[model samples]
Target: MKKQEQDHQKKNPIYQEYQLNLNLYNKGKTQLGIEFLI
Candidate 1:
């Protein structure tokens, strides 16, 4: 059941988009942190 859900997530467009946005948010956070440190 867990495996099936993971496979479904892999195929889900919304889930994929959320993941992309999450990655971008993390990268932006890192850049902001570096600017604050400098």
Candidate 2:
């Protein structure tokens, strides 16, 4: 399941967008774990 999620994130733009948002969130407030939820 985890591997599939990783592969999906690599191929899907929506996932990539979420990843960017995750990065920004991590940078701004350091929650750091939101990327996985996204």
Residue 26 C-alpha lDDT in model 1: 100
The lDDT per prediction is: 0.97, 0.81
**Quick one: RMSD of model 1?**
1.7
The digit string of per-residue lDDT tens for model 2 on 1-38 reads 69988898799999899989988976866555566567
User: lDDT winner among the candidates?
Assistant: 1
Q: Which candidate tops TM-score?
A: 1
RMSD of each: 1.7, 9.0
Please provide, for model 1 over 1-38, each residue's C-alpha lDDT reduced to its tens digit, 9 standing for 90 to 100: 69999999999999999999999999999999999999
Query: lDDT, candidate 2, residue 18?
Result: 92
Clashing pairs in 2: none
Which 10 consecutive residues of model 1 have the lowest summed lDDT? Answer: 1-10
